[model samples]
Target: MTTNTLDADLALRLAVEDLYADYVHTIDDDRLEEWPGLFTEDGIYRVTTRENHDNGLPLAMVYCDGRGMMADRISALRTANIYEPHVYCHVLSAVRILGASGGVIRARSNFSVLRTMQEGDTSLFAVGRTFDTLVEEGGRLRFRERLAVLDSRRVDTLLVIPV
Candidate 1:
């Protein structure tokens, strides 16, 4: 249950990367329910465009505080939502673990979301950096807070799946 300084650092970095990868894959797979499992029970997940969160609009394109709210999001997507059917592919790089504070680990990485539709239309939907906090929970590393600050705010409606 003990990690040396070097091992802790490496593991923490790898864990965050794995989480980020799984994040992209899960959305691509349309596994909305399992997506929330990547977060801690008490985690916070927010999706906001730079214009909004920066201008103090006090609104997020999407915001879920706690696993329950995330779960609600998935539910809405599955049963109560309708939108253009598309596929998503996320490309990430430049991941840097800033440091740790108390029980929280801070990290940032670049992300690009590419989408394709059934009719063969493809485009870059969003590009951004994932700002996250991580911690050990349920015997695993999980996100305690995740903010997807997008570079593209032209959300084409129905961000049912977490970006």
Candidate 2:
């Protein structure tokens, strides 16, 4: 490949990696309100089980169709939703940039989240893979769509926080 092409690829990879880091940190730090800003105005977010994903089912445990919806969910989580006070530590790996075209990038990454409650008990909260469609907006990569496919169907508690 040409030097310019290689440079572009490297830059793209770095940008995507940064986005992933920012995403996890935002959630893990309990800065839920900032989470939605990482997406485009019309971005979509969904969390579903692997079985449902494999079966092409449309059901999702958490579904937000736009940035507005995402913000609303956060609002509900902050003001309306009732659940145990917990924090998530997200470990992300295997971030692969599948393809890029038309200023959009397709990527996937593996993630595992450990949850710690206010009582200091910690446990594996969720293990999943994220399929993301990202676009550059205002000079930064933003998620156009993010779908988290959990490996297991069981959730022991109310999933108030974004995975």
Candidate 3:
């Protein structure tokens, strides 16, 4: 590719990179309402086991389509969700665009989630890849779909945010 083409891809990649980073921040800060704003009105969010995906079984820990569903998630989290005493720190790496269709750009990235409790304990809660579809809208990129394929099942506590 020419330098211009490369630069274009890089720019787009960086934008998505920052979005991924901001996503981690939003989840960590418990800004759940703002979390859904990162996505499009018809966006999708899901977290599933790699085993289930590989086996072609449709099972997921969190699955939502559209901002309304995402809103409901936030409501449930704030008003109804409960979990063990711990905080999750998520780190994302190796973000790259895998493909695209129309305005949608599909991407993948590796992620590691670290957990800490009030008892002065810490450990790796889960590690996996985040598969996402982004679209450029109103001169900005937004998530149209995101699938956090966690490698670890039998989670210790509740997963209330996107990984």
Query: lDDT (CA) for every model shown?
Result: 0.84, 0.96, 0.84
lDDT of 2 at 130: 100
Candidate 3 segments exceeding 4 Å error? none
Per-residue CA lDDT of model 3 for 1-163, tens digit only, reads 9999899888877888888888889887767789888998999899999899889989888899889999998898778878655677887789888976687788999999988876978888899998888998778788988998988776765777566
Which one wins on TM-score?
Answer: 2
In model 2, where do residues sit more than 4 Å from their true spots?
A: none
Write the residue-wise lDDT of candidate 1 on 7-32 in tens digits.
97887778778877888788888887
For TM-score, candidate 1 versus 2, the one ahead is 2
Instruction: Tell me how candidate 1 scores on lDDT.
Output: 0.84
State the weakest 10-residue window (summed lDDT) of model 3. Answer: 154-163
Model 2 C-alpha lDDT per residue in residues 1-163, reported as the tens digit of each score:
9999999999999999999999999999989899999999999999999999999999999999999999999999899988889999999999999999999899999999999999999999999999999999998999999999999999976788999
Task: In angstroms, give how far residue 49 of model 2 lies from its true place.
Answer: 0.4
